[model samples]
Target: MPANAVTQIPAAPADEAVRHFEAELRFETDCWDTHEALSQQADPGFVLLDVRSAELYAQGHVPGALNLPRRKIIASRMRQQYPAGTLFVTYCAGPHCNGAARAAAALARLGYPVKLMAGGITGWLDEGFPLERDAAL
Candidate 1:
């Protein structure tokens, strides 16, 4: 070590580095491609949750999506419906709507793996994905 030379300390192990990197990334920052791909796979354990109000959901929403309005997404109920490790993708009106973000946060806080659908229902519609009016009871 030479005088006036700075020794840069190495970062944590690769696993730790990856964990830190992922932590810095917001769950809502995922792209539409990822959401579409996941939706296409249609895993039995995966769920698409619409966080918009009933009125809004009745007007239009992603096909096969379940309406679980943000206000009704109580932590206890969510935990009961979908234990800790369930995979959930939440969406609201559009990129402008914060309902999805709130819903995702609520689910994540309860230990469910949740992702906010980027651009929300608006994007889903804009991309020409199937949309249903008045979900079947």
Candidate 2:
């Protein structure tokens, strides 16, 4: 190598790079499509979890979402009746809020599978989806 030449870096291993990319893709896909197919499941293998305060949830939220804040992940009282393998999709006020991420983490720690809704409630609203003010019972 010439002293004046800059050393070039090698490309990442194909398998490693693909696996990483696939992981990110899957997560984003799950987030971006949260509203599109959530209700079409015949067996309903997932639950929409609204990680906001009761007041906020009462104002409006994705239809069929349960108002269970992130802090209540371990309480087990607010969860809807779903199978053990059910996925929990979480959302908050909007992209500016991290409640969805925090809720996902909290749910994971409590042994519940979870995902964050991309853009949170804002994304769902921006997509022109209908919102329900009726709080979950």
Candidate 3:
């Protein structure tokens, strides 16, 4: 380290930061509306997935949601079940859990149209949406 040599660590400019923030905000807004609309529509094109463990899923989950645990998302069997081109909406127990994100990422990588249900199952339940016990495949 030389005192005379000044090293500048590049930081994102205010404008750039704002642009990034706006992009993220737009994405969040879009996802929120999409989730809400999908819930109301209950269309088969939109598949709600419970990305938690089987035990957690059995406890409670979104009505008509498929129990596709995050751990099994990358597995061949689960991949076959979900397949590519399917519109997947994934959720975990709550916001703190990254299981939904992981599941979404895995599905995205596999070429599925995936969206992470913001706020997870907690949000769904809080919205007064119905939940079911032990969803059938």
Q: Going through the candidates in order, what is the number of backbone clashes in each?
A: 0, 0, 0
lDDT of 2: 0.76
Error of 2 at 16 (Å): 5.2
lDDT of 1 by residue, 1-137 (tens): 64443446655899999988797564754435645665677664568888888888888877777999878978778767876678888888888889998998888777788878788877876776767897463
lDDT minimum window of 10 residues, candidate 1: 2-11
Instruction: Find the candidate with the highest lDDT and give its number.
Output: 1
Q: lDDT of each prediction vs. the true structure? A: 0.77, 0.76, 0.74
Mark the regions of model 3 whose C-alpha exceeds 4 Å error after superposition.
1-44, 135-137
- In Å, residue 69's CA in model 3 sits off its true spot by 0.7
Considering only N, C-alpha and C atoms within 3 Å, which residue pairs clash in candidate 2?
A: none
TM-score for every candidate vs. truth? Answer: 0.70, 0.74, 0.67
lDDT of 3 at 32: 49
* C-alpha root-mean-square deviation, candidate 3: 7.0
Off by over 4 Å in 2: 1-17, 26-32, 75-83, 135-137
Best by TM-score: 2
Error of 1 at 44 (Å): 5.7
